[model samples]
Structure formats: C-alpha cells, structure tokens
Target chain A: MAKQILSPLPGTFYRRPAPDQPVYKNEGDSVAVGDVIGLVEVMKSFNEVKSTEAGKIVKFHAENEDAVMAGQPLADLE
Target chain B: MPIKRLLIANRGEIAVRIIRAARELGIHTIQAHSTADVDSLAVKLADEAIAIGPPQAAKSYLNIPAIIDAAKKTQADAVHPGYGFLAENAEFADACAVAGLVFVGPSANAIRMMGDKVAAREAAMRAGVPTVPGSDGRVDDLETARRVIAETGFPIMIKAAAGGGGRGIRIAANPEEFDRLVPQAKAEALAAFGDGGLYLEKVIERARHIEVQILGDGHRAIHCFERECSLQRRRQKVWEEAPSISLPEAVRRKLCASAVALAEAVHYSGAGTLEYLYDDASGDFYFIEMNTRIQVEHPVTEFITGVDLVREMLKIAGGEKLRLKQSDIFMRGHAIEVRINAEDPAQNFMPAPGTVTELRVPGGNGVRFDTLLYQGYTIPPFYDSLLGKLIVWDEDRPAAIARLIRALHELQIGGVKTTRSLHLALAADPAVASAQFHTRWLEGWLESNATKLAAE
Candidate 1:
C-alpha cells in the first residue's frame, strides 16, 4: 500500500523555513516516521510538520505559499 | 476622503471584493488569512498579506486577538469583516475599537441590539414595523409554552431567540406536535447559538422572503429598495433578485419605509439589511430580523443601484455623512444573483473541493462574476464551498433571466463539480420562471426531481 500523507492543519506550506534556506526534504528523499519534512505557517508561527510514515518522498505535490486544507495530501511517500 | 490602508479580516470572494473596492479608491489593502488561505486569490491581489492562524475559522478569521494583531502589524487604519464569521460579532467590533482600528460595519451596540432575534423583533414593533403575532417573549417552560400556544393558536414556529441561520427552528402543526418539537428546537437552539432562549411566531405558510437593504450613519438612514430571496434550499438562499416581481407597489413602498423607520429608531450606523416575510395571499408583510452587515446577496442590489456598499461602510466608519439622499436611490433595472458553490447538487449538496484545471468565466454586457479563483487554483475544503457569485442585470426580468442562462452555459470550470448545472436547471423550471416560489419551493422541487436533474 502507498504511504498516506496528512496535513498538520489548515495553513500555507513552505518547503524551507526562509527564502534562502534549503528544502528539508525533496523528491526521492528517504524519511522516517516523526521526521520533519516541511513547515506549516499559521499566524506568523512556523510549525514543523513531521512525517507519519517511513518511506521515500515520491512527490512534492504542494507549492510554497499554497493554501492546504486539513487532511489534504501535501506530499506522496512510497 | 480616501482611506490610506484597509485590512480585510475575512477570506474568499468577500476579501477580494474589499481589496478591489479599496484599490479603486486608491487605498492600500492588507489581506489577512489563515494558514490554509495563503495562496487564495485575495492574498495575491492585496498590496500586503499577514497570516492569522490555522485553517479553522475559529482560530483564524474569528480569532479577534490574532486579527487585531495582524491589523496592528500591517498599520491598517480599518478592518472589514466581509460577512459571515465575525461580521456581526459585537465582541470583534469591540476588539477593533479597543485596538484603535475602525471596524467597517455597524456599531457594536447596533449589532448587539439586532443580534438577538427577540430584541430585534421588539425594536421593530416599537418602530411601527409590522411583526408576526405570537408569544410576547421567550417561554421558560412547558407551561409557559402551552399558555403562549393557547393564546396564539396552533401552527406556530418555535424559533431560537438568538438564532439567525435556519438552524433552531421547529414548526408544530398542532398542540401535540408542539409538545414534542419545542424541546428539540430549544436543544438545537442552545447548541447552535449558545442561547436556549426561545420565542414563538405564527408560521406564515407559503410566505415570500423579501428584505430591504439600508445604509445608515447613526443619525439618518436610507433604503436601497428590496430583494426577493424566496428561492432557497434547506432554508439557505440559492437565488436572489432585486425589486421582487410579485410585490405590489404599495407593499414595496411600505416595506422600504418600515425598514428605514426601524434603522432610524435604533440610531443604526453603517450597512445593514432588514429582512421581512411577505404573505402574498393576505398582502401582509412581517419583520423577520435584521442582519447588521453586508449580505451575501449584496451584488444584486449593487447591480441595480450602482452603489459600492463596502466602500460606503468604510466611509461610514470614518464618520462620513450619508452621501446621497433617499431620492438619489432608484432601481434602474432588474438584477439577479446565483451563488455558484463548489458543491454537488446531485449529492445532497456535498462540498466538492479540488484543484481547478481550467476556469472560464462568462463576460459580457450586464454580467458580473465575483470570485477569487484562477486556473490551477485549489479550493480548500476548510471553509464554505461558495466559490463565487454569478450576477446579471438587464432592462427587465426576462432579459436578466436570459443573460443568466447564457452566462451559466458559457461558464466553464473544470477539475471539480459545481452547482452551475443545478442553477441552469432551476432557471429553466417553469415555476421558477413564473416567480411562483417560496422558501421551501426549491427543496420540494428538487426532492421530486432529483433523478430528473441528475439524468440531465
């Protein structure tokens, strides 16, 4: 079965903390459960969103500054 | 006087609307959004944007502290709550005042007075507006309810004295039904509005829901005419039209006059709508309630009167006088608006949120589409599924209908299903065409014709 991804909450997604910061993870990056992959910012507070399943990053489906709904898939892991 | 900078405290099309109006008046705009609305069209269009909170509206749009903080950070002179969420919330208004930021809506006192249905009804009666005859006030127990019913007769409606949405309403055809439905209505009312206060009203069957749009400045008020919002599904308006076709000239005059009178009596300020229920058979109208903010169907009135209601609200907050006298307001043509929601009408109006692969809005003379969407834009499912509003105006009702039909047909939105097809079918229905509709008419028609609608 494909690894399921979940949104931390409703918020905008940023691949990195700052404009010049490198992305924490990219496509094909191996990730373990509880590993931080991206940041979700709400009300000026940046939250470190962690992976719930250990897998390889299959796709970066959400763009930076993109609004994401709760439970929406932001990335695919396999 | 032009506003320097204005902060929009809500999301969706309303935020876009405020930005456009503010930009048109040469004002810098600040857009505030939840984490889930960072990429919303309004954010892209505004001069600046600040994140408020997470996707849930309670923590974001409805979070007064967060919104105030954003306003102060942006150095915004005013904040506009574009209907729903905290639009009519008195506490938010107070918070804005405390933060020294102008709230581009009614005063907190006006909202507090009108927010309670029972208080509003009483105020309307005192202002000489006709109201439904029922219990004098909230019934405390079964004994009081029985007594009130005995005085008012059967077929009464038990309504949440603090409720606005159709949520906390129960209709009892007789005493037996009343005994069972009253408790249920009270419980639902408490859950929905956080107030168990209940009032009774004589259920007016087959009533046409009409409302008058009013603009006030605390000292004087003017009415912008009326709109017939009788086309509803599950007590929510689906289609709205200005200058109701069924209302006689005398009734229309009385309705508008009464609305102005009520607003003046309250010393109301800013934009508000006075809702009424018209019994066509008896040629009588009764005050229902007052919404102390810009309404969702405001576009219909704007199309006919050419008024920028949001701009007026901002000016009113800045202590501007009534710009135009009552004589300046006159209906030019018939206008109709249909809410294009991101919901499947065939699936009991379930929300259908997804990325838009393609979007083509119909544009022509007398047609306007207010939306915050673009190609490849994903609709977040965290909020209301109302993607946009399709409005059209023409010389008459028939022309408006024709324009609406053409616009709906020409409009193309891919990636997710919408209520466009349902509106198209509703427009073609003969009963809707003839304007023989009530609040329950659309739901009843849809129930019996769901299969037919789906097949089409």
Candidate 2:
C-alpha cells in the first residue's frame, strides 16, 4: 500500500520552492522522513509540506498552484 | 458620462464598499469574481456576478484581460479597480480606456509616472516636496556612491534600482557595513534583477508613518488632512488614526500643502494618498510614495471629516469637479481604524482561514465595522488575510481610544483565531495611548506582548 503525504495547511500547493526552481521530488524519487515534498502557500505565506514516512515516491495528487485544504493528500509513497 | 453600470474588479471589504457607494448613487453593479469567491459577500450584494478565472489571484484578480472582458460582457460603463490587485497597474488603466470604459481613478500617465520610484522621487523634488536625503539617481560605481554617502551620513539604505517591495535591500548602520554590503548588493542585484544599479538613502530611525488624503478633478486638487499609521506589522498597517497627535498644527499644514502640490502637479483625479515619513524630533516630513486609489483606512478620515471619500471617487469618475474646497474641510474629532485580519496573533499571526461559526458586530453612534464576513462563511486562502476594519470616532483622542476599547469588546468571531486580541491589548497599552511610538515601534512591542495577546 502507498502511504500518503498530507498537507499541513490549507493553501495553494506548489511542487517547487519557487517559480524558477525545479520540483522538489519526482515520480519514483526516493523519499525520507523530514524531506520537503512541496510547499503550501496560504495568505501569501509559504509552509513546507514534508514527508513523514520514508518510501519510494508514487505520484502527486495535486498540481502546482492548486488550492488545497489541511490534511489533503499531496503525494503518495510506497 | 455618469456611470450607469459599474464593474468591480476587486474583492473583499473594498469591493463591498464600492458597491454600496454605487448603489446609493443609483448605479447598477456587476461583480467580477473568481471561482473561489463565488460565495463572497461582494458577489451576494452585487446586482450580478461573473466568474473571471480560477482561485489563484494571479489568474483572476490580477488578470487584466479577464477583468476587461468581464466589463465588456456585462455592458458596464465603468470599472473600479479597488485598492490592490491591478489598482496601480498603468496598463490596466490604459486597457480600461481602450475598451471605452471609464477607469475610476487617475489617468494612466499619472499611474505610470508615480509607479516608477525614481520618476516619483524626481516629481516630488520638482514639486518642492521633501524627500529622504539620498543619492540623486542610480549609482553605477562605488566612487560616486562613497561621495554620495558622505553627504547623506550613516545608517543609509542600499537599494537596488531594479529591486522593490523590500527585495534587494541592505541596511548599512555604519561605513563598515556599507563597504561590506555594497559589493554584495551589486552582485545580488545583477543576479536577481539582471541590473547592478543601486541607490542610497538616509534611514530615518525614529520616523512615523504619516499620509495625507487628497482629491483632485484632473486639473486642481485639495487636501483632506492626514492619517497616522505608525502601528504596522510586516509593513501592513494594523491600526491607524486621523490628525496625528504628534504633529504640531504648523507642521500639519505644511505637510498637507506639499501633498496637494504634488497631486495638482500631475493633474491627479479621484481619491489618492501621499505617504510620508515624519521625524518629530527634527520636525521634518519626507514624501515616500503615492497610492492612487481610495485606501482601506479612508474610513477614519471620513469619520473625522464627514467627506465620503469613496463617493467622491465615484463622482470624480462621473466627470464631477471637486465639490468641496480646502476651507470646507475641517477636522472635527479624533477617529481611529483597526484592521481585523484572519490570523492567530498568539501564534505569531499565522494565517487562520476557516469558517465563521459565530459573528457579533458592534454598533453605536460613532462605531462602524466594514467587513466581508458573515456567519458560516469560509475564508478563502487564495489572497490576503484582511477581513475587515473596525472604525470608531469620538470628541477627543482619549475618548476615541475609549470607544475603540468599548467596541472591540462587543465584536466577536468564532472558529478562527483573529488579531482581535492583539488589538484589544494595544488599545489598553500605555505607550500606544500616549502615541509615543515610531514606525518600528509595533514590531518591537510584539516581541514581548505576543505571548499575552490571547490571554487578554
């Protein structure tokens, strides 16, 4: 079963740290606990979305700039 | 031509403000909203609402084409780009004109000129207004910079010509830091903005944030006193008042006149504000920039002067001249406005967007709350956190503070931590009551008081 990474805040999710930056993780990318998978931007402030369970990356549920809610699944890891 | 149908190209409290003024003037309203704001208070109040884009402001509120198209489709005669979003965009104003819709603000040329920091600085200089003592223009080399620094003195700001909005800024408290940071600033500026140009300006350490309200009819202008917004957090004004207690009667007159001169020089139209940094110690006021729209804190000025600023903006856009003279304006009493944002003041003001489980609005002879909140409304997380403004007026400054304290007790919002507690704490603070503070005072005050914000 694939474990899900949850967004800690309700905001717009981004795959990269910045507009010109690369995505923090890609499909099949290795993940570890405390590794930042993406960012959740709410009210103009950005909060990092970190992986809690170490596993191989499966897929991202939300695209960049997509509005997200707290506890929403952002990524899946096997 | 008088605006028959108006399209509001913004959201939140400001959009609701414009709509109320338009309705009173018997104008039809069309609200341009994003998908996320379909349930907003503005949409509910407007005659008709149209979706412009998705939730993100970049594609909706800031989307010029979508806003212009919405206006055209709704057959609106004018578009009011409330305070933020494309309010200061020169191209947006021009686009409104190109579509034959009246832009309810200044001319595009005025917006462009004031939008440029260097151009606005030069304009202020030409109008005989005081500006922060700084280098004349962008410094390309260190030799000229060093020479300029000798005249401006210590504690100067090293700003990138290509950088703005608090980016690419370095503070040099002394010559040593200046020497160390100038080269780093250049390299960073080149890497960030593709230009290594820099400028220098003296840092007024104990300055108060003062701004004058002005109304123009494209040919002449008049001042409407001033507002003191020294209490700010992260450059966002949290509390504001009219008729600054610190300014002497003579200094107030001169500061207001300079603002009028600058506005008339540019043939400004509609409502605008000229921001200044005032040093009470030296009794010097310097023009910083201009906001070419009706501001959020205009209500405090309105509470004191009895001049409806937003209504004046609508009238000016309808081709009306300045109805009141400078002599007609009078400061009646003290008024104050506090911004209520959806953030947990106890939790370092972390954004707290959630449903309003309960709402209790305060009311009285001199109390008013301009808000976009209602019970069960979920605050969308796509934009700023400003939820409303609580305004109060009284016979005197002390009385006004008393009224603020009274009204804040009556106001309530459940299910979300707000800045209400912080405001309550500030109202009871001795330093704030005495008005013994500078622009940087609140940040330092928050350091020791934040832990007690919610406990109050």
TM-score for each predicted model, relative to the true structure: 0.86, 0.96
Candidate 2 lDDT, tens digit per residue, B1-456?
888999999999999999999999999999999999999999999999999999999999999999999998999999999997889888999999999999999999998787666677789999999998998877777798889888988888998765543468789988788889999999888887677878888888989999999999999899999999999887789999998999999999999999999999999999999999999999999987788888989999999999999899999999988899999999999999999999888788999999999999999989999999999999998899999999999999999999999999999999888899999999999999999999889999999886678632
Return the clash pairs for model 1, or none.
A11-B35, A11-B36, A12-B35, A43-B52
Candidate 1, residues B1-456: lDDT per residue as tens digits? 445889999999989988998888788999999887899999999999999998767779889999999999999988999989899899999999999888888889889989999999999989999998887777888887888778778789899988885657888998888888887888777776889899999888899999999999999999999999998987889999998999999989999999999999999888899999999999999999999999999999999999888888878877789897999998898999999888777877766778899999999999999997899998886677789999999999988999999999988999988889888998888898899998888888888878755612
RMSD of candidates 1 onward, in order: 8.0, 1.9
Candidate 1 ranges with C-alpha deviation above 4 Å = A1-78
Candidate maximizing DockQ: 2
Minimal lDDT window, size 10, model 2 chain B: B160-169
CAPRI quality level assigned to candidate 2 from its DockQ score: high
lDDT of each: 0.88, 0.91
lDDT of 1 at B36: 79
Clashing pairs in 2: none
